[model samples]
Target: MKHIFIVSLALLSLCAVAQQKPNNEVSLDALTTETQFSSDSPDLVEFIWWIPNEFWEASFSQDPSISASEAQEIVSLVEDYTIVIALKGKIGVFGGINYEDVDHIQKEFTVTYNGTDLRLIGEKELNADTRNFISMMKPMISNMLGPMGENMNFFIYDNKKSPINVFEEGYIQFTLGDYETGTELPLGSLLQEKQCSVTKKLHNGKWSYCPYHGVPLTNK
Candidate 1:
């Protein structure tokens, strides 16, 4: 009788564990719906953008606290603002307030590649309220859009045409691209100007390329 009870308990524990396991599945449409808030406030609004499964798995393994729901929400939001240029490509740009003080700023932006299960093509941060940071982001955004446009045979919207002033905050832009096999790469993969590369594969098998030079990047 005791053996039977033990066996039942073990099975129940296994079932519970399986139920508690995180389900990483997410949807793009759920992420882009308009939230009740506006971009003018300096709050850490969740921006769930689409990313590749490999990237998502790697990121979740590193930081398990990142919720799958958050990822889905961000992707949906990005998709809503995205401009589809072709059958397989699109570009999404959106921005909201992060934090603003007298001398510092902090903001986040993301780009997605829909070819392979929500791959992240670009992400940027504007910090320290410096003109250099803004200037840096402009090229970075361009780099993210350039390769997508070239390989997918579409043109990206120029952010310079619709400039944003964040007072002490920053803005974000997201771009998407079609799936191209072989060596055809995105702007993040090639040089923009003067030995500057946009994306690089890290030693850890993750691509975090430099925004200025398309080489493996490291956080400075």
Candidate 2:
């Protein structure tokens, strides 16, 4: 009877261990979501790609305040990729896609906001001519900034109204909105409100953007 009881306990322990799940891996399906926001515009779509802070720091060669081990642990809890899109009537949608496929799309955009200054960076396929598109977007970009002061707002226009095309060779444009120089805000301070920005990329390639001057970095 004692031997049988020991065997049963060992089997239960083994079963529990087998059922336990690992902490670090995230599934692509678990990371995507569609969100709705209160606004006059159409719904937007959002995609998220979460990377371990340690991995991000390692990839960027920047040492953030967090420890590598901790970052690795925390990242496991969140998905690695985030993608967002705008839909009808102030509603938006977002979710995470397969990392492999997400990495393949050939378009890119970057936005940098340091409290006062907001920069927009863009890169598109080389085959597509973006000069006209960039020229027309200036006013929209300016309008998106509104009056900059303590807190700022960001907005994305309707994609259907102004569809952006991606081509073979890409372009990068960075637009820096109005900013105050001697302010206390530091670089890379995350904004409190949902800040607006855009980006696209083709297959693990780098996304390009303009400099603080709002001029396409490719030109310089």
Q: Which stretches of candidate 1 lie over 4 Å from their true place?
A: 19-25, 29-220
lDDT leader? 1
What is the model-wide C-alpha lDDT for candidate 2?
0.26
Error of 1 at 184 (Å): 39
Tell how far residue 181 is off in model 2, in angstroms. 35
Scored by CA lDDT, what does every candidate get? Answer: 0.28, 0.26
TM-score of each: 0.19, 0.17
lDDT of 2 by residue, 167-195 (tens): 12222122211211121111111111111
Off by over 4 Å in 2: 1-63, 80-220
* Clash statistics: count for each candidate: 22, 67
Residue-by-residue lDDT tens digits, candidate 1, 82-141:
221221312234542232221221112223232222221222321233224233334543
